[model samples]
Target: MGLADALAEWTDVDGAQYELGRATGLFADRTFLQVKWVLWSSNPLGQALYDMLHALVRAGVLEYRDEPDHQFRWRTAAPIDGLDG
Candidate 1:
């Protein structure tokens, strides 16, 4: 689904998306690099975006965006680093 559609379906507090995204290490915890990479991808079907986005969708915690830097962050209730899939 598109980011706009994802945002429309989100019914939680606005801050949670950031925590989830940051937790994924999908961006190296840096904002601009994340955007630059996603927007400038050259891989087939853009696997970088696809793989990372798939995790977020399965986690069911984030609203994707072309400009994710502007979105809020939400911390998961608990963090289990070693067990993360």
Candidate 2:
């Protein structure tokens, strides 16, 4: 799923996810390079974005998919225990 769609459908804080995706252009561009640049940049927003995604993964709401070419991707996993979606 797209970042915004996954964020909206699966996350508890949809507004924050959408805002973060907009701020980082992650919603508009899902390329590995874009993600790498954002995460590696000096911007504090990058860290916050990374932290939130990490937490989602830990909570089993998302999962990482590593491509053969080393692309980093995230997709919605199984729904969590309490969330309806």
Candidate 3:
């Protein structure tokens, strides 16, 4: 599934935060670079989603924290603002 779909599934659970590894693991069949390329591509939908994620961070609806290993850990600070699923 795409990042949006994976995130939707994660939010359905009772847990309030998700580790970056867990999120990445959802797409284990694909290479990380492949996922990165898709998200960074010129596709309008991808761009929109990327923008929305950053907006969430600015809005305090989401937090992207950096770990000591230089990896990121993401979690919702509030209910996701515009996700429909």
Candidate 4:
């Protein structure tokens, strides 16, 4: 699989990917976390997940998934309505 897909599978319930996919409807959403917090946090997996999410977004494979309650990061479904491109 591609790198972004690989990272999405690696994420957890609060994983940026999971959150992003959940916010697919969009209301001007974004996902941001303090890098310092991640650096200090004891969870290596959390940091890795965040890093992966950011990278995926930067690579243009995904975007900031927004909402009223929380922001998420997710890849957009292609515009083709599941038709093969």
Which one wins on lDDT?
Answer: 2
lDDT of 3 by residue, 31-65 (tens): 54545644545766455544555565576545544
**How much is 40 displaced in model 1, in angstroms?**
1.6
Give the alpha carbon lDDT tens digit for every residue of 44-79 in model 2. Answer: 766677577667666665553334321222443446
lDDT of 4 at 12: 38
- By TM-score, the best candidate is 2
Error of 1 at 31 (Å): 7.1
RMSD of each: 9.8, 7.8, 9.1, 11.5
Model 3 is weakest, by summed lDDT over 10 consecutive residues, at: 12-21
* Residue 77 Cα positional deviation in candidate 2, in Å, after optimal superposition: 5.7
lDDT of 4 by residue, 1-85 (tens): 2334533433432544334433442212433342334334667745655566666557665555444322333355543356221
Candidate 1 residue lDDT tens string, 2-69 = 23333443323222332234445544446644445443456542454445554654565344444544
Q: Which residue pairs in candidate 3 have backbone atoms (N, alpha carbon, C) closer than 3 angstroms, thus clashing? A: none
Give per-residue lDDT, candidate 3, residue 67.
40
